[model samples]
Target: MAFSSDLDQITRAASGDRQAVSALVNRYSPGVLALATRMLADRAEAEDVTQEAFIRAWKALPTWEPRAKFSTWLHRVALNLCYDRLRKRRDSTMAELPERVDMALRPDDALDQSERVQAVEGAIAALPERQAAALTLCALQDHSQAEAAAIMEISVEALESLLARARRTLRTVLMERSEA
Candidate 1:
């Protein structure tokens, strides 16, 4: 059967179709990994989150209602898993600090572009969790404000506020780093 009929596959999986469940995982795994990587900021941790998300999605499949898009539901699940991991690591002791050095921006070459991207990613990673989440959902993921709000379980106005704050914070952080 074509997996494009995702709703049917979901129904079959709900009725205990193991292959259908596998198809669901196969279909959504890449998107889950991308989202996890952006949120977790560590490749290994993102991998773990992606695996855990699929496991949770499979286990929760029976109870999943068809109210929202399946991808949207999966995104929410992955995001929540990332949040849980962040909470668990909140109080961990830090290793010795590395000396801060102002790195020059060299965006001409591909390597320099990659480094610049990584620096920007690091800045985003340092943002407050809610701000990062909001930016990820609305800006990076290209979701509309209303859709992002629905995924975040907040009102559209609240989502817009979060997006505004995230953008302002990112601009300030980037500008400060550039001036350094």
Candidate 2:
């Protein structure tokens, strides 16, 4: 969607325009769902997080500034919701490490490729929160460093550092997994 159209829709939505709100939801839900699904690794929980993110966006629409892309700000909202869920899981009495999913691919595809992908995803989920967020925004979602930094509420330098550490950690974790 074009920026002008987005700006107009957001502006209208903030003023209680139902159609504008629906348009915005349709435009952004997939991205939000992708982010949440990647972060949470559970489709049901990710769907809940995505819905909560949209509800939060509706509440915050009136105060939203158009200085940044609506998608960027929406990502911030979605990610924050992911963080909230992750935090709750961490604090739970029965909290345990995230489980691995056995990826089933086509019969013609290589099993090694599926194993590598699963290992990488498991490594990502094992990362420290900030490192995971940095990698998710910069590597997975293709957000520029500057845009990611703004969404993460960190300096560009800090974001880059997090990315570097995340990459290093992922490599180490994956290597260990392979050796085991």
Candidate 3:
């Protein structure tokens, strides 16, 4: 149903239909933004990646062959952009200074919950890129295993392996944090 709807919208969008383009953006922008945010851990960078992905999508629409689901292809594009950014980070020689946490400040329940969420996100951000991507797609975003696998351009088994490793690492990291 989504596939067909997307195809219709894509067709309309290809012919410079503003409503169709708006509909497509409204439908997919949040998802693209979320995926980029999870992958990059930087809201600004994620927004940039989302905008770039849409720009690329618009360009491709005219010649777009429906070889893969539009969502899958768009996600792959976003993921690749993420990979490029990650690579750039790795290539840079400067080490980023860690943000200081004020452990001295006591927190209310809401602040505690916020801290917990930050902990989990920090753990996820520490993961290897592929593992992080798998966990983000499957666990955070609720994508089906098949869809996540397609987006990552990996076999389902490979995706499962990455997820397993990510889960294990998160468990260990969170447990250690709790103990501290």
Candidate 4:
């Protein structure tokens, strides 16, 4: 199958095929950057995390077992790096704030789409890390409940519980902001 060929490329990269590794980087870097940006909310920090994640992935490739999809593995790496940066910031008393998406350019946009996006992102950023991770992995990243649960190392039922709470909290936050 076509999927197996992609997996072969990853395996080849793991075996020190530089071209294969570079190709993998080219293929997955954008997605990684997007995911990091969504999770971290700071473009510069997200870029840094994205770079570090690739470096880490390259270093760890030889040890990688092809048990899961390569993209899934890469996502886990990116998520771990984001959490590490957040933890470091927390320890240093320098928690970075989420960036507000600009909405001034298109005031007539349907349903105030820009404002809603900013509000949702802000609410997600304010969530507890686990809840945010769950929402990001499931809702934003389009991972199935099983896949998200697998990535989070939680049981399916536990993931469902987390998803429920995350959605409820997000709704409350958005509604409260709308009422303000």
Q: Model 1 shows how many backbone clashes?
A: 0
> TM-score rank, highest first?
3, 2, 4, 1
> What does candidate 1's lDDT look like per residue over 24-143, in tens digits?
878888877876776767889989988887777777778877788777777788888988877777757452221222444445434466567677667666677777788888778766
Of candidates 3 and 1, the better by lDDT: 3
lDDT of 3 by residue, 1-180 (tens): 999999999999999999999999998888889988877778999999999999999999999899999999998999999999888887895524223222222234344666666666666777889998999999989688999999999999999999999999877766665556
Give each model a TM-score: 0.80, 0.82, 0.90, 0.81
Which structure among the candidates has the greatest TM-score?
Answer: 3
Mind giving the per-residue lDDT tens digits that candidate 2 earns over 1-180?
577898999999999999998999888898788778777777899899898888888887898788888888888988899899889988885556566544433335466875756656666877887898899888988678888898888999999899999999877765565455
Off by over 4 Å in 3: 94-111
The worst-scoring run of ten residues by lDDT in candidate 1 lies at 95-104
Ordered from best to worst lDDT, the candidate numbers read 3, 2, 4, 1
Q: Give each prediction's root-mean-square deviation over alpha carbons.
A: 3.7, 3.7, 3.1, 3.6
Q: How far off is residue 61 in model 4, in Å?
A: 2.6
Locate the minimum summed-lDDT window of 10 residues in model 3: 97-106
- Quote the positional error of residue 74 for candidate 3 in Å: 0.3
Better lDDT candidate (1, 2): 2
Deviating ranges (above 4 Å) for candidate 2? 15-19, 100-115
lDDT of each: 0.74, 0.81, 0.84, 0.77
lDDT of 3: 0.84
Error of 4 at 69 (Å): 2.4
